[model samples]
Target: MKNLILSTAALALTAGIAMADTVRMGTEGAYPPYNFINDAGEIDGFEREVGDELCKRANLECEWVKNDWDSIIPNLVSGNYDTIIAGMSITDERDEVIDFTQNYFPPAASAYVGASADVDVTTGVVAAQTATIQAGHVAESGATLVEFATPEETIAAVRNGEADAVFADKDFLVPIVEESAGELVFVGDDVPLGGGIGLGIRESDGELRGKFDEAITSMKADGSLNELIIKWFGEGVPTYNADGSVVTN
Candidate 1:
């Protein structure tokens, strides 16, 4: 019987079936207000809070695993972690490789930050984190796209004049722009991208996906999720209705 059980496990592995005993949560611990390392060197951010609540509601024992943004998806597929709770937007292209839970974050805009407000974001050299939706948008927008491995590097590119502007999520840029103390300013019209941020799971983990989906749905129904959204992204951001529909102010 033990041998039969081992054979079944091997078959599951060969079939790319993923099952988790601890539900390891993967994140890019560099994007603030999504997931980032705190001063204590622990993952702390909006996604961290949300992931913990989701795991609790789903009755799952979960732990976070930090990973580089560029390799996050591949690592999840390789079984380095069970789910990606990073600030990953849901897109059809990514959906082909991994399943996503219903969006926890509302559809947000991407903005450009530059040394000056008059910087031409449409045709100028723009920096974006590699493999992000922002990078793809820049590539197709006639802008010279400079891709960086991390979000911090994208901003640094703008500061050092390697790029005219850095395009990134508005929520991630707000605090940065505010703290720039008149050094950095927003340029160009905000571009709406992606379907909103969701938890990424392997396509083979249907049951695990359902568990998170149900947990997210319950949070939406109870208004706790919206509270958390406002707490992190601030008010006036789009929120969720009881039915899981986005309610924009």
Candidate 2:
């Protein structure tokens, strides 16, 4: 009986070690600067860099898994991956479904990009990526909300006149507007939506969430998190100073 109990405990220990050895990092590899696939077809971007550092700090072997934004959370809940390192915003609605680590990115503005600056964003058709806070806002803003499967499609809707404007994170829209060469311009006021972005994990996986939270706290304390935020989102973006106070524009 004693031998059997000792062997059982050993097996559990081994299993726990195996689980800690490889943590799957799930992300939507389409949101550029936050996360996206490179020409080599490997996940690359700000979240990837931050995730890698976090994994290193936590001493966990990590792998990246790309999933569609529309079903990212459902997949996580269904055990598709260990944790979601995507640029997902933390919100009360989402918190009820899954646990979140402390936010790595600060809350930022959402803006509208349209073909014409005079477009009435409140009444005209506006496009947003499905399952996002921007989409929810558009749906409730007295505008005709057009939901798309991907961010690219939202921008295409505006260009093709399927929608008058596309609402999305201002950082994501900046590059698109610049590349349009005056064809697309920012319209209407910037709307602040959602809390800061965080890593989502299964509610049952409290240990994993705590590990990441510790890693993130270390990054914040050392100012590496702020550096990465500025490196990816550019200067003047809000970030925590060394003293843990938020430095904003």
Candidate 3:
């Protein structure tokens, strides 16, 4: 029930306007720890909390808009939403289309999860959420890449034998692997991908992006950003220092 199918019309009209005073915060509500709909049916999770804090610091009235992952960027460009605070990574290809604020979360590794530790992830069919850097890596790593629209589907592909493994953010896979008990396990060495996670904004919205960047910088300076990172990703999660240097354990 994480993926809420919302009508574009409802999101574009009934939601807050894309004006100077109000900004629509777009997210893939299906991704947990990053974003997910709570039992109260509200967008609640790490990114939601972080986005709320960012808006408050920037002095903008923001409303949440849930969008499917596959069309997130396109919808942003079409004015369906003002900014994407989803757990999207900062990548050069993505930067070509939409501008990104300074990273709020430091770079993390992409890991493979499979039914067995010995699975040949490099040669076997590996699944990844479509449009992610992990999917691009799998396609080029001599693996048969199976793309899914959602992260849940990628894990399902491995569970149902459609794929030998699933590749995703290690932080995202940790809870799943733990919840699975013995069914799922990390299979191979973690692969570092993407620069870091950032908020996606329209290339024309330089002012808006600067506001968020400033807010993020403020959080880092006060150590609140690192606290939030540890709260969600656990202690020892990598973070950027106030001076914008990576802090890794």
Give a tens-digit lDDT track for model 3, residues 55-99. Answer: 999999889999989888778878888999988888777777777
- Model 3: ten consecutive residues of lowest lDDT: 1-10
Instruction: Please list all clashing residue pairs in model 2, or write none if there are none.
Output: none
Instruction: Give the number of colliding residue pairs in candidate 3.
Output: 0
Full-model lDDT for every candidate: 0.83, 0.83, 0.85
What are the per-residue Cα lDDT tens digits for candidate 2 across 150-208? 98999999989999999999989998999999999999798887778889888778888
- Give stretches of model 1 more than 4 Å off: 1-19
What is candidate 2's CA lDDT for residue 66?
95
TM, every model: 0.92, 0.91, 0.92
lDDT tens string, model 1, 12-86?
Answer: 222342455578999889888888899999999899999999999998887989998777777787888888888
> Best candidate per lDDT, number?
3
RMSD of each: 7.4, 9.4, 4.9
* TM-score quality measure for candidate 2: 0.91
Better of 1 and 2 by lDDT: 1
